[model samples]
Target chain A: MEGGVYLNLPKVAVLTMEGTNNEEEAFQSWRGAGANAEIIHIKKLENKIRKLEEFDAIFFPGGFSAGDYVRAGAIMASRLRATVMRDIENFVDAGKLIMGSCNGFQVLIELGLIPNIGGDYEREAALATNLSNRFEARTVYLKITNNTCPFLRKFRINQIIRLPIAHFEGRFIPANEDLLEEISNNNMIGLKYVDPYGKEVGYPWNPNGSVLNIAGVCSKSGNVLGLMPHPERVFNKYTQSDWPRGNEEDYGQLFFKGAVDYLNEKF
Target chain B: MKINIIVTLKDNVEDAEGQSVLKALHLLGYDEVSNVRTGKVYYIEMKGNDLSKGYEFCDKLLANPVINKCKVERDD
Candidate 1:
């Protein structure tokens, strides 16, 4: 495992729904990072849920599913609730990794996948329209909240990474002040808006007016993560906005790297 | 029971959609528009004798705190 370049990389499954448009890119990104990956459409999972067991990790990529009607992620969440909830619970209960990006994050929250403590149906965070009230497509800086979550194991505290966010509703709202404080104190806040220079700025630094400038959050167990930033969109240097001149390496690579490393250590 | 649910952004929270509407209204010569915020209205028919359970549904499942607030009314 130490000597091989692709040694012990895990097999990742990129889950797709009727309207998910980013599955291929996510698959490519994870594969490029040395993980064996493939896209698994929701339709395929409708009849059977055990297919999820074949992979070490699962990902829900970003896209405008079901025309984003009712809400950006409402339809997808409903579908998951109707079908894959049990499979997801079993996977997470097994300590397997699960990730949702952008619209995918919305689905996870809608399906009650993350932020639930002990109950079968618990509400997690919600992603609504941005504070700007318009679809914003731009590269925003994010401060990685220092935590022991497998998702952020390789990231440093206050590290600024540029990621593109394109959505009408990306604002993250948690349920209560106590839950908010718990998430903050536990370092479950995965990302927060920051200045271009990598400093944590408040409000406006919060590109979406999300509470506490939060860009993303995870469950207390850290096995589930939901975020708005498109790490798959920035896996390569060329896709990075400041590629040539910036000293920063492609931060999106860490998403795959961290998961693979965690899985490798498990077996 | 039939209930009406009104969901709106909290006071401190910004309303992007409502702001756009206000801007549009101002452009249409409604210059007196000082502030504008948008909200959702839902008419739901629930089957239950207890109103608390209905409100619980709205509080726990329907409304999200980080972005919106919800109010419930008995249609009758």
Candidate 2:
């Protein structure tokens, strides 16, 4: 490692499991943001081979985890809940960071980490199948709803950015109207799907038809973030689909860099 | 002992898969069908004949209360 600030870089774990194919991208993105990152399999945590306490941040990348058997992230979430539930709670209690994108976002909802209004990790939302009844794979414009989240601190509130989203079940449905209201009342929403003009729209614009056009959600404390877009997949300007048309923003790296910066300052 | 569990999506949630099937059925001239919803069934074999274990499985992993409701049946 280099001298100076690199001497105490934040450690990030890119958690993965069977069918989760994006760990490599997640690991590289974190490393690109000046963090010590490792791709750790979920089995390592389940078997007690790796400890969550060893890492400053955990990232669940996008993929069809556990084959998306019963649901997009049901099996993986259940497995994690069975083994590392308490450890995850302790990790959150310590004000550490956790970010999940795409299927990883579904896993966080399944694990009751995002929009955890009850504060007991109760499953309060489900990302059902898209209203189009088809798998959506495309670049989407997302308006940053809240920037207080550790993962979104680098972005300005209400700023619209483009990110790629690919998933079958990406619709965000809270348990009830009251819970949905509570999520908004608590400022847990992080991003909303928007048109190129930054207007909240439906169908092609909101890819999944998520209620309220919610594209991402954060926990009450803003340490945990779950979103359906794959920011890790587009760590550089060239990877973005429209970059060839004179676009030059490396938005993906900012999400990781923001979390790394937060970890460095707080821990 | 054998236990059977049927898990179904709650009424409030949109059943996209079921809706797709319904659309296909309508295209096939099955307009008589008004609604369609899909679900899953799981069969488990347990050494002990306690029905509570089946419910426990549903609570733990078989079904998520946020979107699904499960029914457990056991044969003793």
- Which prediction has the highest DockQ against the true structure? 2
User: Across the candidates, what are chain A's individual TM-scores?
Assistant: 0.92, 0.97
Question: What TM-score quantifies how close candidate 2 is to the native fold?
Answer: 0.96
C-alpha TM-scores of all predictions: 0.83, 0.96
lDDT of 2 by residue, A1-267 (tens): 666766588989899889997899999999999898989998999889999999999998889998998788889999999999999999999999999999999999999998799998999999988999999999999999999998999999888899998999999999999999999998999999999889999999999889999999999999999999999999997899979896557989999989989998999
Candidate DockQ values, in order, are: 0.38, 0.75
Candidate 1 wrongly placed segments (more than 4 Å): A1-9, A117-121, A202-204, B1-13, B32-35, B39-76
lDDT of 1: 0.79
Best by lDDT: 2
Clashing pairs in 2: none
* lDDT for each residue of candidate 1 in A1-267, tens digit (9 for 90 to 100): 253655456878898877887898899888876787878877778777438888889999999888786567777777776777788889888888989898988888787776674347566567878877767788888988865778778888878788888877888777768877877777688888889877666545666778888887777788888888899998886788768887777788888788878887884
